[model samples]
Target: MRMYYPYVNAYRQNTPNDHNGSNQVMTVLGNGSVSVQPDVANVELGVITENVSLLEAQQANATTMNQVIEALLRFGVPRENIQTTSYTVNPRYDFVDGEQIFKGYQVSNMITVEITAIDQIGSILDAAVESGANQVNSIQFTVQNSDTYEQQALQEALANAYDKANAIATSMQVNLNPIPFRIEERTDTMPIPFSKLALSAEAGATPIEPGQIVIRATLEVKFRY
Candidate 1:
């Protein structure tokens, strides 16, 4: 006996074409970014180590670091600007005659200092060294409020996008500004959290250079004209 099947509506049909349709609406979404190496600034500081007995080493490092902090404070570095990056005690090893022995205890302390005065980077380093900072670990120059600069960049990017759109519109003999159906702002900083670059101030005066910051934005414009 023959069996009868229920009629399937074209709308409800689960055919391949219906389920996975691919007649894409040709829409152009271009992305552009503006980057400015804004003035680079950061905590120009260091870590000092004095290896003796662990206790003495700790005391010495503490004293020196305190002096450094004081000098920085005198140089106008605010209390809140100082960040204690690290502190630790490690055993120093001495190898002799094919034998390894404990030489002494090394005490190390690190503090991050944010110096806003770009002009005094050299003076600050000299002061830190004079104040007893020995082991210079890391010195980094970074933007204090990158967000503000980044926003400026974003605005520039939007303007760039507008420029591109207008150019395209002019080429097509149409005005995009009023003919666009909609203009949506697509903004971002690429990486959410920006990491500051680290440099060593052990050699030269803390290199405080104002470079540029990178920022970007995109706009999806439907220009009917």
Candidate 2:
């Protein structure tokens, strides 16, 4: 019991033992958020499919896919981040008189690139186009990074909490101990998961935009006499 008292001392009226000299010490959490709707930027990088033969088709698709990756690398995109999101090597089926016939294997490899630089998006797309990446995917605006903004939001939440505590304490005619008796923060902000984040990679330049991203944080502080 005696040891736990120190935790609350910081908020109590200042005394010789409590260095916090009653400076309206009330525990509060403020909330803040920074957002910027990024300009549209994107380029779809994919392989073209042509069935010369089942094996030849696969080989050709792989070669073309590698060219696209090379183009991205040339544009300063990290090779590791460029991933093959889709791959398929299947025979094309044509039904004649309800009879299915295997024409040839349609092999294709499609990669998804996480473009970090907004400005380079257009250029990257252009490069993909020049590198024989003809199939354009979906594109749109979204947030690439949210950790910094999330921290900002947390600060704002703390401020809000402090204001609330002060108003309540003042209304009760209490000095609010000028500090927080108990400070608690609980937030479930999923930091930019791959699943939750995305920009359309549809065909035709995939006009993409990393629009404004919203980040929120909440804080709870309890003040005691």
Candidate 3:
């Protein structure tokens, strides 16, 4: 009895055109993932203020934001790591009996802060809130750079493809030919899920845990036999 190549038939339609279109071409998918502790954390903090006048609202928001930035700086955060991400001023309105009424103006100022000192994350969050940060939009943990991890994943994926191709060829009693072409289906470093925190002085230091970040890559390999 001869072994039938079921895997080859499964992916026969997607075989590379440069190779033989018949049962000679086999396509296989290989995946690789690498996980490591996160090195940096990004936090988005915002200050919202409302007043009867637009100038007053904006001024109040700006003052609070300045205090927050100053606190972060005093905590050893670099100036370049602290940046204002967004600022907006909008009018507040109320609808009563199908009529629009102007209530007051609202100002929103948001900033993104990058922390390289992982151990200081909790302290930094506490300081920001104590200084006047009202809204904590999100906190994300990720690696500062992923080039090294990306290369490692690519190498692992390619090695996996090679081993799989050989194993299938031996099992089917066919001679595996050179690889004609391969495609990198996907490669990315994904950040951990972020959580929103309510900022208050009474809450004390915000506890932050930076977990591991996962880097993954997938490849489509075509082998001709």
Q: Which lDDT values do the candidates have, in the order given?
A: 0.58, 0.60, 0.80
Q: Rank by lDDT, descending?
A: 3, 2, 1
Tens-digit lDDT track for model 2 on 1-225?
Answer: 011223434334553433345444455554555554543333335776768487777777777777878888888888766777787777788899999987767776777777767877766776676676766565544555555666677667656766787787778776554455555655433322222223233434534344455566666565543
Q: Which stretches of candidate 3 lie over 4 Å from their true place?
A: 1-23, 178-180
Comparing candidate 1 with candidate 2, which one achieves the higher TM-score? Answer: 1
- Writing each residue's lDDT as its tens digit, candidate 1 over 44-112 gives 355556565787888888888888899988998899988887777888888999899888887767777
Flag regions of model 2 displaced more than 4 Å: 1-30, 36-44, 48-52, 94-103, 134-148, 168-208, 220-225
Candidate 3: worst-modelled 10 consecutive residues by lDDT: 1-10
Of candidate 1, the 10-residue stretch with the lowest lDDT total is: 1-10
Runs in model 1 with CA error above 4 Å?
A: 1-40, 144-148, 159-208, 216-225
- Measured against the true structure, the TM-scores of the candidates, in listed sequence, are 0.61, 0.59, 0.84
lDDT of 1 at 113: 73
Candidate 3 lDDT over 167-218, as tens digits, reads 9989998766545354545677889877678768888777787888889877
Task: State, as a TM-score between 0 and 1, how close model 1 is to the true structure.
Answer: 0.61
The superposed Cα distance between candidate 1 and the true structure at residue 188, in angstroms, equals 7.2
Clashes of each: 13, 38, 0
Best-matching candidate per lDDT: 3
